[model samples]
Target: MTLRRRATGLALAIATGTTLALTGCDAAKDAASDVIASATAAVASAAQEKMNEIKDGVDAAADVKAGRTSVDGDRTVAEITATNPKDKTADYTVMVNFRDGDGNLLDAVVLNIDGVEPGTSKSGTARSNRTLTGDTTAEIAQALRH
Candidate 1:
């Protein structure tokens, strides 16, 4: 038996006032046993809704790791991790868009990661075009293979 844990805070989940922790086999079984009946239904429904909204009828070929945005001195930086699941090497261009509390686009930037090998993951960062105020949300505008 092996156990691995990587914990990171996600802005979207935090914004939604929810926290989801999925652990390895043993811990997963323990978590399953601890959840209340009604809460399970609520979590499933909420997850499905969020998936549909994010996918927008498009299939997700790749996965974006839990991302976080933070104020970096004079600029806001968005960091994202991506996993590529193919044999050949590929380049990914990820657009990280910054939005205001009202869902208005504030500033955006593209994070380019080159030469991602098969079945491997990498981290990339993008800086906001301009300073943003108030509640800022960072989302993956696009994750395309080239």
Candidate 2:
């Protein structure tokens, strides 16, 4: 073959290879984006399911209270003295007593704070005088509202 013809053939091959490689890379990126979108949707669905479960549990506890059944805590005793629900704001005086399931008190602490909105629930970590396991105060608050 002539040198010019050979050179032309080599350039065409390189260009074709580069174009194919770029097309493959674009396909891979599109696939990755699809997978990420699917995973994000799954996570959002799971979170919504969990929130619904919490809301249902709270509603069930409310029914139990209405039936005159005591919905007290097994691991903690929470005394909510003040629940002043103003317009879009709620103030509460929460007294928590860490206890066993058998009504035996383990430790006690008081938390008086504001800024909880009424009709809408909020949750956070409890800073007690004694260290306790899990979220006892938050559970108590949920049960009380129910």
Best by the TM-score measure: 1
- Runs in model 1 deviating more than 4 A are 1-61
Q: What total of clashing residue pairs does each candidate reach?
A: 0, 1
Model 1 C-alpha lDDT per residue in residues 1-146, reported as the tens digit of each score: 10000001122322222222344466654444343223323333333333334332233235664366788876778777878777777776665667778886555455667787889988787675445567787887666665
- lDDT at position 119, candidate 1: 93
Off by more than 4 A, model 2: 1-88, 131-146
Candidate 1 overall Cα lDDT vs. reference? 0.55
RMSD over all Cα atoms, model 1: 15.6
Task: Estimate TM-scores for all models.
Answer: 0.55, 0.30
Candidate 2 lDDT at 33 equals 46
The local lDDT score (0 to 100) that residue 122 gets in candidate 1 is 81
Pairs that collide in candidate 1 are none
Question: What is the lDDT for 61 in model 2?
Answer: 26
